[model samples]
Target chain A: MAFISRGFHGRRPSAGTKLPPGQYETTGFPVLSAGPTPRIRQDDWKLSVTTEAGKQHVWDWAGLMALPAESPTVDLHCVTKWSKFGTEWQGVSLDVLLADVETAAEHVLVTSYGGYTTNIPLADLVDGKAWIAYGYGGSDLAPEHGGPARLLVPHLYLWKSAKWVREIELRPSDVPGFWESAGYHNYGDPWREQRYQGD
Target chain B: MARAAIPGRLGDRLRWRTAEVTGRRVESATAVTLTLDLPGWPGHLAGQHVDVRLTAEDGYSTQRSYSIASAPNGRSLDLTVQRTSGGEVSPYLVDELVPGDRLELRGPVGGWFVWRQQQTEPILLVAGGSGLVPLMCMVRAREAAGSRAPFRLLCAARTPSDLLYRSELRQGAPGLDTTYLYSREAPADSPRPPGRIAPEDLVRSGWPPDFEPTCYVCGPTAFVEKTAAYLVLLGHAPERVRTERFG
Candidate 1:
C-alpha cells in the first residue's frame, strides 16, 4: 500500500515532550458531555466535602473565591484523544479545602450539579494535584465548560475531571463512577493509553 | 414469551474491525457517503455513531467519530463525510478514498441519543451544518420500519446548495416535516431571512410545547448549546432535550 500522508490537524509536540500517547494538541477547547449542560445558578451553588462518618464541610461560591486561589497552567488530555497544552485556570487547591477535614478515606467521588460523578484516588485530589477551578483564561468559567467550578485533575483523562463539580464524598474504597461503570478505565492515565477497562 | 437476542458480533466495544468500502456516492459538493461492509456487523439503532481510523505507511494513525447515516440493514452501513477544512481524516475520506478501500472502525457507539422504533413521542430534530448526519439516520430508520412517528427536522445550513439529502428530503418520508434555515444563502422563494435558526423558528416549525416532543440537537458545540437552551427555555423539560456536541 502507498503511504497515505494527511495534513496535521494541530501542533505536534517536539521530541522528549510530555504530551500523552495517542493524543494531539488542540488550541480550541472541545465541549464534551453525556447530556445537556446544567444551568446552575451561582447564588444557589455550594461546594461540600463529606466523610463516610457524616462529617461535612461546605463553601458557597463567594466563600470559595475568597480562599487562597492560585492560577495553574497545565495540559488537559481527554480520552477522546485531544490534548490542550498550557491552559491556564484559577482555583483553590483541593489540599487547602481538605486541610481541616479529617478523613481516613482512600477514594473520592466527585459529584456535579448535573448528576455527573467520577471517582479518583483520595491521594490524587490532595498534595496539590487537583483544584476546584472556577475561572479559565482570566475570566469566570463558562457553564458549558464545567464552569463556575469544575474539578481539574490534570494527570488523569479529562473525564475524571468532572465538570460542574459540587461535592466530594470520601469513601473507604473505590467505586466506579458514571463513565467507569459504562466502559472507561477506572484510572485513566493518558500516558499509558488507559482509555477502556483492561487497557 | 421469549425475547429475541441481539444478533451479530456483540463483542468487545473497543475492538476495531476491518470494513471495506463497498459503495460511494456524492451527497453534496462538500460531502460523500461511503458504504461499508463489515465483518460480523452488528446492527445499530438510529442515531448511533462509529469511529473510523486511518493508518499511514509510517503507522501514524488518527480516528474521528462519524454518525451512521443509514438505518439498520444487513452488514452494510453508510458513513457520510464532510470535508472539514484542515481536518486530518475527513479530507482523505471525502476526496481520496475509493470503492474497495478498507479502514478500521469501532462502534455503534452512543446509546443515549438513539431513536427507537418503539418510541411513539413526537421527535424534534435540529441539525446545524454537517450535524444532519445522525438525524438523517433516524429519518431513514423511520422510513425503513414503515413507522409513522411524527418527526420534524429543522436543518440549519450555510446555503441551499449545502443542504444534504436534498432530493430525498424534498421527496419526504412518512410523517416527516423538514424546515430549512439558511444562515448565508436562502433560495429566492424562501420565506425565512438568511440567518441562523432562531427561537422563533422553533416556535414556527417545531411541535408546540404541549406536544412534548423529544428533541435531539446535534452540530457544532455553539449551535447545539444554543438550540438545546432555547428548547428548554421554550417550556420543554430539560430531560427531553438530548444533545450531541460535534466540533
Candidate 2:
C-alpha cells in the first residue's frame, strides 16, 4: 500500500511542492495492484484481436504472450514530459499480435483505466514492435506500474502505454482517450511536442 | 511511404533556446523572471508550459515543465522557477543556468486550463505558491486582449513574500477580481479568510450564480483534487471545471 501511494509521489520535495530527483524515494512502491490485474484464464481472459473486417479472434493471456515474446530495450516517454530510456520488455510484437488476426484498418485505439484511451495506426503500434508487457527489466512487472500485463508501444509515446489494460479494441477509425479527449493530441508524438490543444 | 524527417539530434528532437534573461525581483526567497531568447517563436497560449532540460558536463540531465509567466504577444518566454530544497531541477534552474545558457526546452502544452480571449467563457483561476505560474499567464493574456470576461483569480501562498508574480499580477491588473489568500501572513483587519482554503470555506464563499463560469485549478495535485471535489459538491459541473494539476 505504501508503495502504491509513492507511485503518485516518489519523494518529498526539497523545493516548494516539487519532487526531488528520481533517485529520491517518495513513499514506497506498491505491494499490490490498485486496479484489476487481468488473469490469464484461457477460459475467461482471452485476447480478442479485432480486424478491420470486424473479425475478432480470441486467445487466452498465455496464448497472447506465447506468440513472439521479444526482449527489446527502448526509451519510454511519458506525457508528463519525462523520458526513461533503455527499459526491457517482453511480449508479442504488435505486428505478430495482429499477425493471426486480419485487419485492413489503418488505425488502432488503445484504452485503459478511467476511460483513458489513445489511438495509433496499426502500423504505428507495430512500427518496430509493440508489446503486451508482462515483464519489466527481468522480473514480472510490479502491479504498481500495471501488471499481469500492459501494452507497450515503444514508438509513439508513453501515454499509449496503457496500464491496467483489460481490453484491446481494434478500430478502423481513430478516437482519443480521457486525456487525449480533453485536449491532448490524438497521437502523442513527443518529437512533435503534441502536448496540448493548439499545439 | 510515411518517413519522419530524420532528426539530426540523437533522438531527432526539436530544441528551444534562451534568447536572453531579464533579472526580475529575487523577491524574498523565490527567483523570478527571465526574458527568453528565440528566433521565430511559436506563440504559446496561456496556461501552457515548456520543458527546461539541463545537461551537466557528464551529461547528467534534469528536466521539468514550467508554465509561461508572460503573456504571448510575440514577446519573450517568461518562466518563474522556485527553489525547492532537495529539488534536482528547480534549484539548478535558478542558481546555475546563466543567460545564453545552451538549454533544451519544448512545450506550450496543456489544453484544458487554456485561457483564450475569443472563447469568452467567464473564468475562475485558483493557484497556490509557484503553482500560480500558468494562471498568471492566462490573466495577462486576458488583460492584454482587453477582455471583459469576468475572471476571478485566487492565489494561496504560505507567506506574503512567497508569491511568484505578485508585482506582475498587480502591475498589469486583471479585469477579473484577484484575491491573495495568505496562510502564514496575517494581514491587518481584513475579513477573516481561512488560513487554508478548506472545503467548508470554499462552500461558504460560493461562486456567483449569474454565469456558469469555467474554473481552471492548478497547484499541487492534492490541493487540486480536494478543491475540485469541493467545487463539484458546490454545484459546478465536473467537466466545466477544467484543471491542470502540478506536483
Candidate 3:
C-alpha cells in the first residue's frame, strides 16, 4: 500500500565493490550490457555461427552441448570498473569450435539479441581457458547469465564475456565490440587495468 | 548450479602482497587514510583506482574500487577511505581494519578518466567527498606530465577532516584553485569558502565567459548528476564533460 520504493543506494558504489551472498546476481546481468536470453522456450534457444567466407552454422540445444566444453578460474572486469574474480564457468572452448573449421581470419565478432556484439582478437578467442559456456557455477546456465550458452572470457574485461551469443564470425583483423565502439577500451586487460578510452 | 568449469593455468596471480597497512590516521569522523606498502611498484596514471575486496568466513565476498591517494609512482598506494554509514564494506575498512593487516588489492584501473598536464588547459576537476581519489590521480599525473596548466579542483566534503586529501590539497593549492565545501562542519582556519556548490556558483567559477576547457567530474551519484547538470547549464557541452561516479 506504500506509494513507492526509494530504490536508491544513497550514493553510487565505487568500483571494486562486491555484494554479499544471497545478493549475488540478485538483479541479473543486463547491468553488464550482457544481453539477456530470448523469452522463448527451450526449443526456441538456438545458436548460429557464420564464417566471413559465408559458411553458416545453426545449432539447437543438443547440438551445442555435443561440442567440447571447458572452464577456468578467471576475473571478469567491467567497464563500470567492478572486477568479479574467481568465478567458475563451463562451456565449449572457442578453440574447440574452430578446431574442425578453417579460416584465415585472426579475430571474431560475437552478436547476440539486444544488439550486443563484441570483437575478440584471434588469440583471445582461442584461449584454452576461454569457453562457450553452457552452464555456470554448477548448473545449467540460467537465462539471466545467458542461460543455455554464453562466451566466457576469463582474462579480458568481462564485457568481452558475451552472453546469449548466437554467432562467432572469424575476421581477418581486430574489430571493436558495441561498448568498445562507444568509448570503452579495446583489448581490455585487468592487469593493464584498461577500463576505457580504447586505442 | 555449480561454478562453471573453464580451463587455464591460473598463472602467476598478479604477484600481489597483503600490503601491510603501514599507517592509519583519523583525519575526520567519517574519513581515514590507510597507507600501505607497494615498494618498487610500477606507477599508475592519475584518475586511476584500485580494487579492494574483502571476504567473509562464510566465503561471501565483495570487491570495491578506491582511488589511489599515494603519489604517482610512489612506493605505496595511499587510499583515503571514507565510511558511508550504511556501506557494507567501507565501514569495516575504516573502523575495523588495522595496520599490519594485509588487504587484497589491485591497482590503477581507468584510462580516459585521467589528466595529462601537457597539452591541457588549466585542469578542472569536480569531486564530492572521497570522489576525490581519481581527481587526485589527475593532480599527480599533471605534475608528472609536467604540463603548465594551472590545476584546479573543486571538492565538496561534509567537513575539513571529511575531506580525504586535505593536506595534499592545501600543499598543492599554490598553483591551483581549490575549494572545500562542508555540509556539516567548517574550520576556522580553512582558506576556501564553505557551503554547498550550487549550479549558480559553479557557473560563476571565474573562467573567461568564452572559455570552454576540459572538465572532469567525480563523486557520489547525486553529486555527479547535479554537477554535470550545472556544467551543461554553464555552457560546457555534454560530451566535453566526463564523469566518474563513486558511491
**Candidate number of the best DockQ:** 1
**For residues B1-247, what per-residue lDDT tens digits would candidate 1 score against the true structure?**
0111232233354677888889999988999999999978878889888877666666666667789999999899999989988876788888887887887887776656778898888999999988999999999999899888899999999998898999999999768999999999999999998998789999999988889898989899999988888888898877788788777
Interface Cα RMSD for candidate 3? 14.7
DockQ of each: 0.29, 0.10, 0.05
What TM-score would chain A of each candidate receive against the reference chain A?
Answer: 0.92, 0.73, 0.77
Q: Whose TM-score is higher: candidate 1's or candidate 2's?
A: 1
lDDT of 3 by residue, A23-132 (tens): 22212232332111233355777777777787877778888778766666655656454545467787777776777776788788887654567888878877485788
Per-candidate TM vs. native? 0.91, 0.65, 0.57
Across A1-199, the per-residue lDDT of candidate 2 in tens digits comes to: 1111101222222443332232222332212111122223224444456666767776676676657678888766555645555677766666766666656678777654333456776777765657777788799776535666778875665667776555677776776655555455667666665654445
Q: What is the TM-score of chain B in candidate 1?
A: 0.94
Q: Which lDDT values do the candidates have, in the order given?
A: 0.84, 0.62, 0.64
Candidate numbers sorted by TM-score from highest down = 1, 2, 3
List the RMSD of every prediction in angstroms: 3.9, 10.1, 12.8
Off by over 4 Å in 1: A1-19, A173-175, B1-13
Model 2 lDDT per residue over B1-247, tens place: 0111111122222344544444443644756566676656667778777776555544344457778888896747778878777666666666665665544566555444577778687777878777788888888888788888877788888877787766766665645677777787756764655487776555444365346777778776656766676776677765566666654
Q: In model 2, how large is the Cα lDDT of residue A139?
A: 90
Q: What ranges in model 2 sit over 4 Å off?
A: A1-77, A83-106, A111-116, A121-156, A162-168, A173-199, B1-15, B98-103, B168-174, B188-190, B204-210
Worst lDDT 10-window in candidate 2 chain A? A1-10
Q: Where does model 3 exceed 4 Å of error?
A: A1-174, A177-199, B1-15, B57-60, B141-147, B183-196, B206-210
